[model samples]
Target: MTDQTAPTDPAEVTAHLDARLDDDARAWFAESRDRIGDDPAAVRVLFPAVSRRVGRGPLAPGGDGDDPFVWHRDDAGRALLLAAVDPGARPGELRDCYTHGDARERRGVLRSLEVVEVDDEVTAELVDDALRTNDVRLVAAALGPAGVAVLDDDGFAQAVLKAVFVDLDLERIAGIPDRVTPELSRMMADFVHERVAAGRAVPASVWTVIDRHPPADRLAAIEAERDHEDPHRAAAAAAALDARP
Candidate 1:
């Protein structure tokens, strides 16, 4: 996946992946990249071979802070593979790649959306398909920056609600701050209400989204969170209330 450091720019990502590879793997990667460029159909074969060819370790190691995008070595390889495809054929290839490939391959296609050029409708369909699945990893991959860029307001809010339904960490869905809407706040509040009524614990991460788009007239649910037994939820509610206009 793309990050602030790499931003999914194919050239930058290639360089990042190249620097981490040993001499032999690096050579293989370069050859594969060019081979896919020459014969776009070859990507079907090379796409799944990335993890074996390049290590599966994080391309950039995480540290103590808000987690940056952690691209596995194979993820970068796959993105580069997509980038190597002829732009005219890339959309069809991407759709096939997502359809035929297993979960990880599908995730790679979703995460690599920004790096490869394609029709918005094509990416939208892929994102929609991923969001419909019960697979948590695939769902999370679909809500990432690439997916975020393509989803409209209602679709995005529903996706966030879907994350809650499947118990995904809201933090994993990047670009939430910029994408938040009152509809999202309402949906999150409804979720909070259901959980509270059922005596189920609310995910603390949901509060982050609520705080971001705190509905002007519906502060009660969020305000009530101020005294939540979980200190994290309590603090998030306190912040949301204190910041309320």
Candidate 2:
């Protein structure tokens, strides 16, 4: 049997994290300090979160309370100083610490806050409006794949259809047009078709929109294409078809 030794120094374990800080991260840390005042506990929480994400622990051995590398300070001074010095620290991570942390922490950092709740209907409405304007960025941001999945699962076909229509800029419902719109339509259709071919069901809501908006021939063509190679999509398409009359 081989002899096993316990891990020795924590410092040795994390020796690689001692890199210098870049200019932007340093500037942001200074700004954060000015914004949050000199609260040690607040700084401790904020810095540790950033350090954790950046692969640095909060403390260095034999360091004083003024030690910039110590992760558990209650004031912003050390944290800001450490961040300013450590070039590898990400400004985005620090920003996220201010934004995504608990309410109290965020309030402490930002000083003012507003809470807005956009429900399904409102979100759907916003998505629809965004799509109609061909606002790809807004549409994608508002209804990411996860949001799309949620809308599909919840049977929000009209919403999905509107989103797709707007995103693809489909002017005609049934016939394949001459412009790039048809290509986008075909691509989306093909995507659904593959899903159906794979033995997956399209969300019922998506089916509802397809049924109401598109011409029968176009719909049938899309259905026929469902026999393509994706099993998961195939199943979804079958479910979507079943959801229709």
lDDT winner: 1
Candidate 2 residue lDDT tens string, 131-169: 344443334333332223334322333434455544332
Candidate 2 weakest ten by summed lDDT = 1-10
lDDT of 1 at 243: 44
Mind sharing the TM-score for model 2? 0.27
Reference-based lDDT, residue 128, model 1:
96
Query: Candidate 1 residues 137-218, lDDT tens each?
Result: 6787777777877888999888989988988777567676667887888778777755654445666787778778776555
Cα miss at 12, model 2 (Å)? 49
Stretches > 4 Å off in candidate 1: 1-6, 62-69, 216-245
The positional error of residue 2 in candidate 2, measured at the CA in angstroms, is 62
